[model samples]
Target: MIFSHEFSETSEYSAGTYTTPTDYFRYTLKVFEPGRSVAEPIMTIEEDYAFLMDSQWIAQLPEVREESVSAAPNELIVYFCDMFPFQRSVRDDSTRLLRDEIHNYIHNDLGPGMLEAFRIQSSDWGFIWYGDWTSSRPGADSERLSVALTKNGTWYHGRAPARGHSWISISVEGGVNAYYENLTDGLISAFYHELFHNLQRNMSLELGGNANIDGKEDAWQFFTEGMAVFASSIGMTHVQFSQTTKARAYLAEANKFVAGGGLLDGELNNSYKAMF
Candidate 1:
């Protein structure tokens, strides 16, 4: 059996006419074991009260302008916009490079069988304008260039956003040069890393599991990041890997995991330490 709850409210007050009211709620879920005369609660789950609010106001703003390029039916819809002239140039080139690499990796490495299993019919992937990081920018950094998230993920919470089987965002701020000296391989590696994450999420969902949980929500950064790093390195040629420091570093870490027989270890909590 399954159960759920939802709440919503609307107000007719102008911006200053009224103050929003907070609604606190609590709920409990109990599982009972069937018995001849009585049923006893075997498991009881309780949640503390929470003030849930409609967050549509926090959504991503509509794109200033967008341009789409043609791709295979199952391939990504590449959107290039919301960038300054120089950033646009870098994004344009990076988009093309990432598109080709993703296609090749999916077809050659991951294979059509895995693709069919994941049920990824099509993906919408693009680069967005992220201004260069500053001390005042808080958590903004060049590392934000590659990110993949589901429809319900935080990245899609605010503003009008496009819908697709999956959405991958690459930041166009700071330029590719700022992150890596070798532009082509660096962009390719980043794209593949995020692309693998999309695949991981899709595969988990198809298998009747939640990626955020089954994929280790608590230690996600350790496992998924390690897997993505390994994937990014393996997707490219040794020659290309030799040219990119990030790729080389990933390979080194992956090698350590393999060499230490980490895969044979039964300890799940310490697995990430081996990869590191």
Candidate 2:
């Protein structure tokens, strides 16, 4: 079963334990207004995310969930704002119609730009959910977050200041269940982007440098994006993924130039360049 917990402007932590890992998974709602709660959804997006914490998905995504504070701490805050489709007609003032309008605008207008916006918001979820208490920022990043308690561990997520650089993740703003469809292959991009950013925290890399392949931190971003875009059904066959070796893949190039490396990091790296 699913247990839902809601947090408010004055609310902080709950008072007890939850259910099992599979039993208790948490998700954050993107409220456009100032004061909103899950009970009062307002918006219908859950940020682009999902996790099993089963340990077997490691190779494909290779990462484990670590436990944080015992109670809710705005841990994994997810911030989302519905967009109005640029050239579509709202027809009326219904939420369903509004959501459709927003989706259309994303596809035709924002185009690739939406990728940057979504990534910025998504990484916040990763940081808040996994980062320690002392790692939180107050008024600076004023987005609200929520968490659900489970028997195994609490499901944490939320949003932070939306003004940061889009270094950690690839954000796709307009659609729900994006993974199941094909559009420049955005779904696959989101999937790999999620783990690459989340797992990068554990690896040593130059992530937020200038170029996409800077070093430690930046490497995974390159590795994943390159592979994802290349593998994307969008059919970016123009750039080769296998023959690309070049070794210039994000994680690989970064560690060699600076200092970094870890499990799955390398495969994610050189393997992509191997395509060129």
Best by lDDT: 1
C-alpha displacement of 155 in model 1, angstroms?
9.9
lDDT of 2 by residue, 66-163 (tens): 34443112323222233312111123222132433444443453333333323333343343333321212245232212111111111222332121
| Full-model lDDT, candidate 2 | 0.31
Candidate 1, residue 85: Cα displacement in angstroms equals 5.3
Q: What are the clash counts of all predictions, listed in order?
A: 5, 44
Off by over 4 Å in 2: 1-64, 67-75, 86-97, 100-188, 205-213, 216-276
**TM-score of candidate 1 versus the correct structure, residues matched by position:** 0.36
Error of 1 at 149 (Å): 14
In candidate 2, position 9 carries an lDDT of 34
The TM-scores, one per candidate, come to 0.36, 0.26
Candidate 1, residues 1-276: lDDT per residue as tens digits? 668644335344344332334444456787777773335688878997745332211112223212232111122222232111112134445533342254343234323322322232122233222222111112321112123211222233222222112234444333332335443334344456555665565445445665562244354555565666666555654633565444353654565444544333223445565534
Task: Report the lDDT of model 2 for residue 68.
Answer: 46
